[model samples]
Target: MPSEAPPTDFSVARIHETVLQMLGAGVLPPVVQAGHPVLRQAAALFDGQLNAEELGQLIHLMRSVMRRAPGVGLAAPQLGIPLQVAVLEDEFDVDPEAAAVRGREPLPFFAMLNPHVRPSGTASVAFYEGCLSVNGLQAAVARPENVEVDFTAPDGTRQQRSFSGWQARIVQHETDHLHGILYLDRAELRSLSNNAEYSARWAQPDIGRARQELGFLPG
Candidate 1:
């Protein structure tokens, strides 16, 4: 007789239950909101203050929290860490047409530490953007479509690369967090909408209509 198959379904359900228990118990650090002082202060560079092992553990925790939030990106300050670190990944599955319109593509998970970005070109695009820190609000903000960034990895390796489209936006957004800049600072105030309203009215990626109807600045 063949050996019995492993109880895969039971294991999976047990893991899910464990996760819910952890969440309810607040085992995860709370994501700091917009008004938190850490979100408004420039984060310090890693500079080897923490040992490599410690830094690795912190990065792992940050990545886990980001995934649990179901967000594409997270910055250290967003978690009140006050270190120049961030992690981002995109599934690019929200809406194919919307993703294409925004030039978003699936990106594997990556971490950036002490990153700096430079615009690759003068051209910029405006889109409705939301932030985990800001919570529930979205607005139109213009940002360069291309950028080159230099950053240190968790392993202390320096790397430089260019990104375009939604990837560039993600890099820029997370980098800004290191400098204590929130998306709302760059957003058109009149374009602000609650997440519910944005889903109901502005979910289609219409920059022109958003500007006209929502009083967003022209891209």
Candidate 2:
């Protein structure tokens, strides 16, 4: 007789249990910091890797963590899950003058799964960007001004959307995480600044001043 097949691993079940344990403890794990091997590895696509209930649990955990971090976006890889999922939201509350200068606008909260983005045009804008995983430092990154994105919704619905300005930047930043790309990979390295210095000197709505001072051209 043929040997018996190996026992099922039930990976999804195990993941579900782990998620519930974290939720049950009432203390979510800290965001994984930079330098973790997981942070550099490309994330796997979500194709029923997690069931509906497990997906909701994971998303809830991510939302809570992102809000606590006070960031506009969070990726699954940032939490060490290595899935192509992220949550992003911004009130877009900058003053009118600053908002107009940056083309910043509000983005309602939504969770994107397996998002793919394409630049709308050749135009690019540069701005200071930060990440929870990278922590404590911000750098100027140039990204396309607008993009068309196709993603699966939290409900497993296929969706396509367009984003411009600040929102466009956020989408690209998070999508890059899924591919193991950090903003630093595309940043003007000389423009890197601690949050304090960023607020003090490079805090303008435009990067023109930082560009002149840091001696690097935006892409």
Highest TM-score model number: 2
Query: Could you report the Cα RMSD, in angstroms, for every candidate shown?
Result: 13.3, 7.2
Candidate 2 lDDT tens digits, 161-189: 99999999999999988877788888889
Return model 1's CA RMSD, one decimal: 13.3
**Which residue pairs collide, candidate 2?**
none
Off by over 4 Å in 2: 1-21
After superposition, which runs of candidate 1 have C-alpha atoms over 4 Å from their true positions? Answer: 1-26
Clashing pairs in 1: none
Worst 10 residues of 2 by lDDT: 1-10
Consecutive 10-residue window with the lowest summed lDDT within model 1: 1-10
lDDT of each: 0.79, 0.84
